[model samples]
Target: MSNTKNTAHGQVQETSSKSSSGTRKPIVLMSMGAQERAGHEYQVMTKKYMRPLVEHAGCVPVLAPTCFGSNDLALYLSMVDGVYLTGAGSNIDPSLYGQENLTPEKTQDQDRDRFDLPLIHAALAMGLPLFGICRGMQELNVALGGDMYQKLYAIPGMREHREDYSASVAQQYADVHTVKMVPDTWFASLMQQAEIPVNSLHGQGIKTLGKGLQALAHAEDGLIEAVHLPECEQFTLGVQWHPEWQAAQNPFSIRMFQAFGDACRQTVEKKSRN
Candidate 1:
């Protein structure tokens, strides 16, 4: 599935094969971030987020740039079986959630915020499997009418969740905290565990959950760590952690991505019939 060629318009054209079970690899549309470097702005997505989908999830990753906005969204959604909203260094614009921007030093990706919020609702409307990580999870929440703490550490009773940028990559990604799974929820059932340790690397956290979004897990400080939409008939889950970082080696990360891949394949099968 590694073979790919760019179309005249620069879109990735992947060549994939069907498994022995006669099922083709599921296609997942992942959102990208806008970054300014040197002199020009670029749409970017790190390979860290893409590798988990390919290696563990057994899916083809398609990158969606934020610059396109809503114009071609339906076209992109039409071809993919699942949507993956990945984490980014930028925070969502605080204005979207009725809050003023407090962290001037921390960057905000409004283009991505504009693009992903609508993408979240539309993907769920189509019954596509959707998985969000870190900022992506916060987007899912805000899209569904929830808000976030502009600065989580400033909030009373909440622990500092941001990683040390000065540390080594391995040190920054090391498991630093625990999240207790809500019993009988989709996450608990899939993980088959009461609690799991996770790496934290975000400054903002969910303050109020979106409508129909169930809290799947929580941190020791009572922060929401994972979420799912129970009413949605598809696999819709979001986690406020860097699950994509070394996802292949972690037991919990492996199970999470595999479950998303299965859901995406199920979606493909359903689409073929309809």
Candidate 2:
């Protein structure tokens, strides 16, 4: 292992040689948000908001671009210590979730799903710490045999989670509703609170949790706001909010990243020893 280096185009990975005891940050492979940029097709990238949070928590950020095949996937799984799945402007294609009622207005990033879904399962199988936000959570659920409500507001009791298009960014992310924490749940134990207010930025949410996973928090309308895989050996927690947007100032958001960073340190250290 040498100093921090670039292994591939648009990819950044840091090794143990340049890191310190408490600073020997583990390389966390973050799944990119895909979309066509300018005239380029399949422009693989991630939001800038997620970087500082992971770095402040003692972890190195690396872009895990859409791995196109099994060999690429295998290479990444062996290189990184943890995974962070970020929110996206696109939605997972309805076909993957056994539903086909995708509204024409709903954006779909098929390229992102192809790699993210497989990465989720692979990381979980190998006991790697994984954290997902918004679309990331939805993909986690679908990857584990779960389904989602395409438009939660359509339900009789479900509150609309979409933000007002005209509101300022601050107003949109402002606490719009409350989510009650389930007692004795994995997230409850870490968050150490009974309830939390989160930003509403998605129309889709987990309608049915995947196998081996349980709801950690729910909205007043009974819509799941967070999920955790209790049976998993490694750390796994997915929230239906954009914590990265204000992770540095938000208490809950900070805790989430810090906890994940600790897990990543342990995972990488163990892997290095082996």
In order, what lDDT does every prediction score? 0.91, 0.80
User: Model 2, range 88-149, lDDT digits (tens) per residue?
Assistant: 88888988889986676877877678888888888998899998889889999999989989
RMSD in Å for candidate 2, one decimal? 4.8
Top candidate (lDDT)? 1
Clashing pairs in 1: none
Worst 10 residues of 2 by lDDT: 14-23
TM-score of every prediction relative to native: 0.93, 0.89
Model 2 scores what on Cα lDDT?
Answer: 0.80
Error of 1 at 229 (Å): 0.3
